[model samples]
Target: MLGVEAQKSPKGKWTMPPFDPRFPNQNQIHNCYQNFLDYHRCVKAMSRCGQSSQLCEYYFRVYRLLCPLSWVQRWNQQIQDGPFAGKI
Candidate 1:
């Protein structure tokens, strides 16, 4: 009953996956922040060894959906200046 029930795919079709209710009690803002952290961590680990970051794209997409533009802009700046710069 929680989470997004329908998301528009690249081809513009609505697909339903198995219902897996994660973060049942957490709000969307918290979820977005957590997702951002996870994504950047994944990117850092993957790129540190010269690995392709194609697998980390999922977290970026989810974060984009749940976070606001202001939050993204601030985080982008942090990522650019912080230790994770150029990795994500």
Candidate 2:
């Protein structure tokens, strides 16, 4: 929800709005993790419905700015090797 605005494009796709500059430094690590999870869910839901994945990019951009690379890498490894596999 960070960069998801209420506006829609002519094609009815949810567009990524300009990110609020205040958001990158607004959350702690745990909050960022939750945001990442929410982002994954958004992508999964959209893709399941055959919608474009463009809306999901906002979450990625937000997380990239907020999370450390180490945390992202660890979660990525978990997705690859742990129960999170095939879920993310």
Candidate 3:
């Protein structure tokens, strides 16, 4: 499950993480969140285009609306700090 730090405060808590240079520089984390967001957005767009709602509801209803979105959000955070720093 996603730890408290990766959560988006859907329940009114503060959503941002305290900055730490040792790890993610925001883009990585933001990209991950956006990836999930994109999937759901496509689902909606598809629905508007006459696709059945049941076709892609899995990502939004079963995943995002549930607790797994936050957990899937931590995919890149499991790496050690600075692993990608100053690479070619």
Best by TM-score: 1
Model 2 TM-score, all chains together: 0.59
* Descending-TM-score candidate ranking: 1, 2, 3
lDDT of 2: 0.61
The residue ranges of model 2 lying beyond 4 angstroms of the native Cα positions read 1-27, 84-88
Off by over 4 Å in 3: 1-27, 52-70, 73-88
* TM per prediction: 0.65, 0.59, 0.31
Give each model's clash number. Answer: 0, 0, 0
Regions of model 1 farther than 4 Å from truth: 1-22, 83-88
Model 1 deviation from native, Cα RMSD in Å:
8.5
Question: In candidate 3, which residue pairs clash?
Answer: none
- Lowest lDDT sum, 10 consecutive residues, model 1, at 1-10
> In lDDT terms, how accurate is model 1?
0.62
RMSD of 3: 14.8
Candidate 2 residue-wise lDDT at 7: 18
Find the 10 residues in a row with the least total lDDT in model 3: 79-88
